[model samples]
Target: MCSCQQHSTATSVATLAPNGAISFRVEDMTCGHCAGTIKQAIEGRIPGALVTADPASKLVNVQGSADFAAIKSAVVAAGYTPSAEPIG
Candidate 1:
């Protein structure tokens, strides 16, 4: 029960993106390392793009002209499952 409580607490600590940024929920990211990998993967596919993630919130914010499909693909390539909904 303690572990379950801890997990719930951690999940509640995630941060959401500020207004005007494109955001999505990534299901498989469990830590900072996963976030870093996701960021790298996005930047690799779309150079000069900005990517940020809050693992607790399971939210990923990407700043760029890349379409939703490209962003989704990048997240998938980075080993995380990304949803298509934009968190405005």
Candidate 2:
């Protein structure tokens, strides 16, 4: 007997967009290391920040109340270009 039920094996990316949450498109983020670096950079600057980075998409999402400028600065400090896509 074979199971015919369709199931999703793909892992969904959990992005929390609470108040003050921000997402930035990072250029030069080519691998997991880059993602980890970016995550660390932001978390270092803003304690209690939850950062999720997808290297494949070059998108880093931060969930915290940190200042926007500080987040951008952290990206720059990590040697990556931060491109903010305005959310309407």
Best by lDDT: 2
lDDT of 2 by residue, 6-31 (tens): 22222223232555577667756767
Per-residue lDDT tens digits for candidate 1, residues 14-33, read 22356555677776676777
Model 1, runs deviating above 4 Å: 1-18
lDDT values, one for every candidate: 0.66, 0.67
What's the TM-score of each model vs. the native?
A: 0.71, 0.71
In model 2, the Cα lDDT at residue 5 comes to 27
